[model samples]
Target: MASLLAAVVSAVVLALSSMLSERHCAFGFGGFQCNDPVAGYGSVLLTATLASFAILIVSALIATWKLVAWFRAR
Candidate 1:
């Protein structure tokens, strides 16, 4: 349970960081261009946020599921 909560939190952080690393300009680019510093960084963060946290989220879910199963088995 604790680990799952942690994973959920981690996912949220990664997702949010990935989003914040980029500065969205509604008027600067006239909403036509998405201006984000170092496209590479944004891409990397997005990938990491999705991939790395995906792993954690899956693992955490599995752990919780197993825990539940174990408890129910008893």
Candidate 2:
């Protein structure tokens, strides 16, 4: 259950980070564009996404371990 919760949280964070990274604004006339400085194409976003994936993997492993243990116990 804990691992499942962690996986869900990480998935949410990954989705939010991906959305923030893609956020942009367009200007009129000149057709200029602006992106969020914090989340725009950079290492920060990449790191966040990677971290989330790592957490997800860890959670999945934990869940699998618990499942296997349960099956063995029964």
Best by TM-score: 2
- RMSD vs true structure, all candidates: 5.3, 6.0
Question: Model 2 reaches what TM-score against the true structure?
Answer: 0.65
Q: Quantify how close model 1 is to the true structure by its C-alpha RMSD in Å.
A: 5.3
lDDT of each: 0.62, 0.75
lDDT of 2 by residue, 1-74 (tens): 99989999999988876676556434447443346565234456666778998998999899899999999999
TM-scores, each model vs. reference: 0.47, 0.65
lDDT of 2: 0.75
Predicted candidate 1 versus true structure: per-residue lDDT over 1-74, tens digit per residue: 66667677777777676565455322244332334554335555556567757767786887788899989999
Q: Where does candidate 1 clash, by residue pair?
A: none
Backbone collisions counted per model: 0, 0
